[model samples]
Target: MQDNKIKQEIEDVELIIGKIMQIGVLIAGAVLIVGVVALLVQGDGGYAAGAHPSRPLAILAGVAAFKPYAIMMLGIFLLILTPVLRVVVSIYAFIKENDKLYAWITTVVLVILVIAMLIGYFGK
Candidate 1:
């Protein structure tokens, strides 16, 4: 009975995580579409060629300025972040299940992910 309960809980969490992924993708796709639309409205056949700020904060600033590439970059950034968020949620789920090994593993994975992102963002 206890095993069955655990299985059921895990399945439910899995379903929620699936929705999170879907929503994240949809959000990113929508943003990309908007960027395309902006390009269309500007009468440019495509995005204006130029350097887009790679840093997250800089990207946000550019998005605020309504730069098409920046909007698209923000979308791509969020798309990447979605799976990272999933991993975070999984860590919580693992802790709830009292699964120490999996929890520790997830924590390590999260740490590594953060480190990588920092390097990507802050490194030249």
Candidate 2:
């Protein structure tokens, strides 16, 4: 009985994570589509020649200014973030289930991901 309950709870967590990924992809795709459509309608890339915002704050500023490239960048950012979000949720679910081993493993994975992202961002 306890095993069955644990299995069921794990299944529920999986379902929730699936939904989160699905929604994240859909929203990211929609934003990308909007950016593409705007680019097509404007008949230009909407950025200075050979230049686009690469930093988060710059991207946000460009997005606030309605730059199509920034919108597309945001979409890409969200797409990349989906799996990170899944890892975070997995960590929480594991902790909830009292699975310290898996929770610690997932936490390590998250730390690695963050480190990689930071290196990628600042390495440029």
Choose the strongest candidate by lDDT. Answer: 2
Specify the poorest-scoring 10-residue window by lDDT in model 2: 38-47
Per residue, candidate 1 scores C-alpha lDDT tens digits across 11-101 of: 8988888999999999999998887888677755233455666888878887888877778888899899999999998998898788999
TM-score of 2: 0.91
Cα-based TM-score, every candidate: 0.87, 0.91
After best superposition, candidate 1 residue 90: deviation in angstroms?
0.7
Model 1 has an lDDT value of 0.86
Query: How much is 118 displaced in model 2, in angstroms?
Result: 1.2
List model 2 lDDT by residue over 28-104, tens digit each. Answer: 99989988998888876678888887889988887888889988998899899999999999998998789999999
Off by over 4 Å in 1: 1-5, 43-48
